[model samples]
Target: MYAFVSVSHPDEIKDRKRQGKLRQHAIRNGIQRSKADRAKKDGVFVPVEMEGKTTVATKRPTNTVALTKAPSVSLMDPFDTLCGCPERLRSLMRHPSAKQAGEPIFCVEDSGKPFFQGMETIFRGALTDPSLFHALSLVLSLAANNNLPNVEILQHRGEILNGIRVNIKGLKGAPQVSTLTAMLLLIGYEYRIDGADCNTISMHIQGVQTMMKLCKERNVALIDEVQRALFWQDLLSCLMAGTPRFLSHRDFSDFKNPIGIDQSQQWQVPKGLEESMMHWPPECAIVLEDLNALCWIVDSECNPDQEVLETFPIDNTQANLESRLMDLLRECRNNPAEPDPWYEACILAAYICTYKLSTGIWMGCYIPEICIGQIFQVIAKIPVDAQYKPAPALLQWVLFVCGGMTERKNIRQQVATLIRERYPDPTQDPEQEWETLRTTLKSFIWCERTMEKRIFIFWNEVYPELHTVDSSRNKMLVV
Candidate 1:
């Protein structure tokens, strides 16, 4: 079941063509320079003046292309051709169908709809750009062929990295939105494909954040629907890494709310405890948004001042959220009738995030083991179709959280089985694949051990597996 249910329509070709013409007109009138033109002028050519003579100087070329009347023939690496060089990738990306397709190649698991609105805009622009397309295509290929053998995976990984380096080295002066998108894709590749080190991913996140700020300063509106989705994903990554987020609430201010319960006054729950439990307040989305925003503030780059801390006391905030959650759960229990499992699952997911935020701020002082177990139980009761329908991205994160927190052997096995069933890898052994995923989750948690000295010390006692010198050590599986 996809977490989000909103379907996206393809952008009108004429509209994009009109925008392209207007942009060209602006460039002709000196309103802006084409990114390619700017790239060419920016340090690509150096003027040399000697004895009143001027000559254009060029650096050693990465590849050779004969200058002739006929189409220049460039000799390139075989791997480059096989992997889809930037130019070739760009052409493929700009195909009219690419815009119509809406979804990025790497996000195929999220078929039937674009992850969010404004993705068309980002994809449309990305397809026509060489560097961005190369990065985007690399990520897409990785996601599509995740089950490839280790040898093939390594080969592809190397080629993609080289392609990124060659293209990015050519980008000079100010960073463009396309460049930022490319960087975001690279980070996604590291997280999803490579199982990259936390420090490496953190550095890339920081780089993207810097690029975003640069775009804003230049009046470049880069944060569209696609970017908002990426930003949210990165925020989740930050939480796992125990690092502050680069993209904050202000960056995604224009983001649309995820689909949820009806907020209209005309919408009402039936008059029974079981019925009410099966329904969520329209305000549920608002509360989730608030929780996300509060999480951003709590994990902001700067430490919270004493005054700020006092105003939004972590303990009180968590208690209130938990209380509200319990009230809803209690209503269902009192009625002796089962609530809609799906609705109950959604509430449990929301609480998981709420608790996660609190744990991050307080260094896991309040373990939500009970809530975590409830999430698994409710999820187990939910139909497979329902689990994937509402919002896949959100659902994925919630499942990741559930996987991370649970120590119960049966629950861990269940989570692993569910993941394999949902996202099968035909090339890999299912058991081994799920075990690797579990290890990855534990590694992520282990990396965050230094968020607070006391917390680290406390976790060392509670989670003895953390005592190992190798920070990459995985926690012991709970029997």
Candidate 2:
């Protein structure tokens, strides 16, 4: 991935508040020197000396050092390369005219444009450029379809599970592409072109899903791509607010009347804690990094006393229960936070749970009491759909947990089960239920992990080395 490091001039340090006064003191001493020069004559300091000798007066050292304010030149080319940018773009980053000699460096370009304009421009360019767009799409598709292992699938097959590992080596040399939207388009193209191989298409889809998920997780914006167009800030808000449990007790009375605490108290919470609570229900508060922002939003939009406090206790309990249940849907599948709006919207759908049979805690721990009644009324209408159907993985997880294949309610359970048709005979030894289950799940996970690692290692590491060796002979012959 392309990244940047910020650079600043050393002279800017002197003007900092802690050092500004010292700098001024030094300047004043220079003024004193100038004053002493005026007292001398003919550009030389001469003094009448004893015994009829004349001598020049000692002069203080100059305080002035050469200072040049120039636009950063070293970084210009690399930045240009990253954007697929031409020379003209440099004008956009340069100062319009020279100014006072001592100001800290800044992009003198007009502030009328947004900070992300450069990113947007490059994205647009990538969309129009075929080669760049194709590479980006492939990268995104790969990111979307990543699936880690589950325990049950392995144990059923007499296998063990290992942890998942990312092939960073392959990622490093992958084709370069610009713009999130372009990447998605390219991924779609790959799927269309591959034809007939459902597995290959599925893999491409996963990649795209991963890319979009990462973008959402990172809070990056997809300004205007048709494939993914969510703004980063909006995605985060959705992630925080869409939980049924968090929304269960939410005040529907209008933005002015919030469900939790009075507006004033909301400001007291830390930001990182509030954000961390995004994955948690409303009752549990976490210490967060952006406490100040949390305070601002709560004070401005939320009013707890008018909402939750006024509700009946039984109603509040029901609402709390429903929220917990809904939150479970968000975890049912692995979705990366990426800039793709569709993937984000899909993840957001966890709040609108009607398709499957779920109870209060399984939904969301913090869903408002009122919404539960609302959702409870219309759950029959939601349709069940799983793109790239991860039934196999799901099956594995269920088997690992339950210890065998069984159905609980409408949900499928995949645990290893120990069954007794009748009372056990006195002569029979008791079955080792827990250890067998653990061993089985462990084996299942290990097998899946092994395959995934093999694919990644060979493609990312082994293949590259082999390719390098193969190319060496050809290069020598050409030379």
Candidate 3:
């Protein structure tokens, strides 16, 4: 009778109702309280409700630290703090001895708006990322201390390499843009540190190629102006180093026109005269691409078969490209009384590349004296201040071509002095290389034979390592 009369207590009913409400609230919010919450509720410490906020309090009257909500955390990047002050960045970029130093072959214009924008983005990201910042700082310090003795230079170089290693290791998990930019900075750093040696630089470029492939797979488009500039820089680096291009044909397929050529097919110089040489005709890119491809073919360990050879028109292709380049050069030369030194230098570089491709020698059928003289004339007319504004690689290559071809002792000495004064790096030798090249040129001059034929004979007899073609093959004359 007692069991039958038993009924649920009012407090138990209220407790059940509150439990159901909590379940419903958790379901609605898609958040379930963990076992820890239950354990906390069961402990001596009880949660006190004040207004709508719940704060925990201990039953034991022991002294306890009051807990208040922490201030909201700021997620702003540290680099952003420095972004508003560009003067600091400009100071960092400007060479300390820019005024005292004679016109450098290349000088970065820190005050330029475009440079500021580009650097702002780079510096912001670098500052936000510790590894990147370290690597960049080390490289900048190395540049600043370039005049230091070999021992100190080597120490900084090792630090930079360590920083690069750390950054590269972190790249595996980094965001796409971050990885790409970091790799670019590393590539630039290597170029500066080691000059044109492709040994290390190619590794960074290969990494970029892998990243680009990943971006492609993810359907990420990298067609912005900054990316385009980076792409061009990578392309030019590969061309100069004689390495295979990182960007495949498909990489550029998205471009309506690959080289930005219009319907007219006329060469368009950039609007700013200062940038004309910096921005070569899109055609130059195409030609450089072809040249790079040819270099790969020539340097490959496995020789291509007739079918593979036919796939790319490497034979006599250089002559055709060189002809087109010469035509463009003539057009530029005819435009005005004062020729653009940068443009002229670029055209001359194209000529040198094509000539070297067609015939395995620095000088082609073109008269060395005439070509050398023209380069010097154009260089003399260029304003000293403006002369330093062009890219060092372009100017260095121009000087290299001129130095390699010049038969005059005085002119050769002048080019050597220029190289020593402007770029003292041994790897970027217009001096040491000139010594070897001068002997070769003199041998050809004495034999009254073109380098095309004489190079094969010289290599077959004296230097087999420098030979690219078979000594028995007469087909090398196709160019």
Candidate 4:
């Protein structure tokens, strides 16, 4: 069943938009150079002079401050004393749709793992643009109203806003504005704040408009390069299970074209799973096996239940596609560039495991458990002699599957065996190494892209309803 029964709608909270708008107004009025156009180079920050006050004279400006280098930064500055955004944010808190005393909310603790925490580093470092900041501010404000801001917020506000009037708090470097804005932009405006408003359709549209207004007022791009990056991040989070750390820095590349399948597909599957299969769970292996079986059944006389393909009953499927996807990987094992056409067909068949039986649900139960044993097994079983070259795509699939799964000892062994079996020497042709590297990279990218697709569908379509249903049932049980 879907999980979001008790989830509150943000819009359901009375005047949340009004509160948010007011705060946005306050931010517009209070913030200096909210626009990227006004941003000074990192080293060039002059004290924002007040009308009558002098720059707080501390020790002479250190000559050592690297003017050419970016300024030192924090992900979430707990030292900020500025409470400028809180009052307006608190106004949003009073919204009836905001979290009530017993309503269910996203598990902040579940999200607190260090792997997730690293996202802050990505925010502070690679993602220092205005769209990101606006997104961050919006999410944080929502977070503030839903639950108490982490104690860190209070501590930082105390420090940053020290001796300053409450009204002027948002002016000084408000990290929340930067951090949360990035997150919202990353997750995008489509996500509904649980418990806010249940009836309004197209939360993404509302979110985008709200975010765009903030961006326009601040003169940030509603959709820009950084926005694309943030979108990618959000997509990855939604589809792929576990923390962000498993997703590496090299995974994101400006040069790579994002897989441009339908937005619906984007919602359904994550990218880069061609390489991520290493992390799949044992259950995924079973699912992958089933998918291989399904392909066999489709080609043969077995009359499988048509409903097994339906997306909604995924968790209850007789031959869970997720398990089949894992088995497909195991069967695909690492062969070099040359294998028989039938073997190639076997590899292509593996992708079907990712497909829904009927409509459009991406059952990815195999990704987290995928390891090298299965991957190598597929390769070792498929024979390769001089007469036949494996489907070129097989290498890509191998790398992609490995990327999603975790690294087990078997994976390393398979890698070694595949390389030795395929290109036995360091002196192997330069062209071949290049091909290998390129294929590997492609697989990894595909894995990441697949992950992104899955996340969007889960959060936007699945989780909200599921959580609501779950919450409703729980409440009923309690009563």
Candidate 5:
């Protein structure tokens, strides 16, 4: 769960246009960084020259090594020791990645990469805790199947649900870390499978909330890991339900508003936001500043120490961002600014960030449909003509975010076409397009490390005929 922070040197910030590079995830060592640096300078992607597993090679993990928990693991090791990752998940998350074939575009399969924060600790408890093992096993099964509940998943889920019903009656509150982990696991599993609004999911969330309240009554403090995970889930659930977050008494007092370094100050506006922001509702702009600040925290402060985390929790920052946007939308619902694509695009980007970054469930979970629908609406309303046209740079960012949000091939192809409509130069190679667009997106709220591979994929998909000759070669060229 360590963040992939990609901070740029301060002295070079201006000359670099405050652009940050996500150190490549596939090659989690310094060698990849050097290659990526060279690629950036030359405006190209250079694949690692490896013998067995090429940097860009990706496939299903049918006959691969079993990803069981190791005795010890490196932070960059994509596999966790306690909770073994299934090969199927590892395949989908492979950096030279494509989702498992036939998988839906924006499904739970697209949750962040394999390794996550506090995962090791949680699984360590599973070693001796039957309940935690069952809960965690069910979650891994759900994720492995892309949240589709299979026979085994159903049986396991039933056991956990029924057991909780009976055991919860005699509880002395959120009694143990293992107990809390199992509960959180079940809450995450139900939400991804049945959605946040489902009565079952709500039941889990409320039960956790009640337990936390009871623990506070007895003055038993939760460690940071469990506290952070619970806080993140509750905030996301609140956003989905269109209700204010139920930050429990303990979490509420412990967590404060965002306190990270403010990189959005005098933020260099990208061409996209630059052209259209003047007309945006004032409130939206305020939220955007906060949005950039959150993006910076998530993107650059990857490995914050405990004290740093205590002061500037990423979860609180995201919760605040979502709340502000929802508030602004409420105020504007009466007489919405007549379909300003730029206006809606900014908001859409913010929602995507909040969901994609902070949804503590690393594998499977539902992103609320509220923002998903708005993505299409904004796309359809995009003005094609030059008169009163917003910058394509904005569209590029919006469409890329929207593409990441959807699993439908049609939607993705449509995104490439529209993006091409603005850039309309079949003569341009993806390397150049990515380089140009990459710089433009940095000015907006984006995480390059998380998105660079997707950007390359979209660019290639949109212009496969750009003299690359061989399609497979084109995709691999960027490896």
Candidate 6:
């Protein structure tokens, strides 16, 4: 049944290229010194001032071949070559027609996770550069079929690395943008190839970071797509790495509101949500804030721009939030006394929210299912009839999201029954009933990346016929 419906984001991941000349010259692609002219150290960066602006310059290799006019860095460098793969193999990487989401070639199960939307084609080859073509092939193959032999995977990986190394071996400035994409693709490949067996993606991630640094410090501009890909990889990998995020200091996630959130007047919570949860920790609050912003961005249905990246750089925003939750979950379990059911439930709810918008291979492959299963055990500790004194709104959000994420039919029915028990459709204001539910969802976190049809199934059951006229819009099921 393809349990979770995979969605490609509404916006296409277009090439982001900005051309500007370095202070010394007025070229559209910016200030790039010819390799032969780069007389300083081969890999060391030296500051160079031009037109009153200071930019870094790299020392070049001893033997350099200088072109009469340096070519501009294009994300799609179609003429680039050096991938030694035979034509038979190269043919496999080429798709004659564009495949829609959920097709055999467009597999994105855990790859899309909760909210990693609009990224279906990132691993698909840019088809411009040969090295990148190989990298994309490996990632595409692994994503399409996780059970491919390790030996085959390693051979393809080696070829990708060798091709990239040779292509950028003597470049004076940053590696070509397609090479940057390939590097990002390799990180994605390693992550998929090795679940938690090892952390091979770490070195690959650091390598791309180095390439990005070369571009920025030297006034070399990379395509916007590559930078965005870097942030996404940083976000997913950090959860398992347990190390501080690679893009730690580069966060810009703080925007109270951006655009496209249609709700105006929020419905009054049936209970005092804020007053009751005075005991909640600061970390919980931060995660909720991050989730709320995510809800807005997802609801906006727009491509994630600089504002969204800065505000919700998963590397820091989600990684730190998950780390804090881990600590809290551990402390709660290790306490000398019985854990606070309310506190435990709250964090578990927030923990579930972590996957509501994004899902990926964390410490455990497909950890979303495992973590959501544990949620029931915690909820069991609380009596069914008893109200969560901390906040009922929080509980409802948890039940609905947890219900959508759970694949088990009986468990989902149990969740739907629980939600109905609290807010029955017997109310005189049935329209208001549905409105109130969406209001609460928005107040916390909700996005289409969430299991849409599943959530709507629960909603239709809980409050029959309350679905809006446009409810069928954006149906997520693939089969």
* Candidate 5 lDDT tens digits, 193-296: 54445555566767777776666667764445566667666644444443344554234543345445464467443444655767777666666766665666
Reference-based TM-score, model 1: 0.35
- For model 5, the superposed segments whose C-alpha errors exceed 4 Å read 1-131, 172-174, 194-200, 221-224, 238-244, 248-255, 262-271, 274-281, 293-344, 351-374, 377-393, 403-414, 417-443, 446-457, 467-479
- Candidate 6 versus truth, CA RMSD in Å, comes to 25.4
lDDT of each: 0.46, 0.29, 0.46, 0.35, 0.55, 0.53
List TM-scores for all candidates, in order: 0.35, 0.19, 0.35, 0.23, 0.55, 0.48
- Model 6 misplaced stretches (Cα beyond 4 Å): 1-130, 147-150, 168-172, 197-199, 240-243, 249-277, 286-396, 405-454, 459-479
| Model 4 segments more than 4 A misplaced | 1-210, 221-225, 234-479
Give the alpha carbon lDDT tens digit for every residue of 236-351 in model 4: 22222211222222333431221211223213112333223343344443334444333333334323333433312332232233323323333333334533433333333354
How many residue pairs clash (N, CA or C atoms closer than 3 angstroms) in each of the candidate models, in the order given?
12, 87, 0, 121, 7, 12
Q: Which stretches of candidate 3 lie over 4 Å from their true place?
A: 1-92, 96-120, 145-176, 193-196, 215-230, 248-250, 253-347, 350-479
Question: Candidates 2 and 5: which is better by lDDT?
Answer: 5
lDDT of 6 by residue, 153-236 (tens): 577788788878887797787677767776776765554433533346767778888888777776654344455567656654
lDDT of 2 at 162: 11
Model 2 TM-score (2 dp): 0.19
Q: Indicate whether candidate 4 or candidate 6 has the larger lDDT.
A: 6
Which 10 consecutive residues of model 4 have the lowest summed lDDT? 99-108
Highest TM-score scorer: 5
Better of 4 and 5 by lDDT: 5
Candidate 6 has its poorest 10 consecutive residues by lDDT at 97-106
CA RMSD per model (angstroms): 29.1, 31.6, 23.6, 28.9, 26.6, 25.4
Model 3 worst lDDT window (10 residues): 98-107
lDDT of model 5, residue 391: 58
Please write out the lDDT profile of model 1 over residues 26-109, one tens digit for every residue.
666563446657767854764444443544443443553657555334422222433346454434334433332212222322
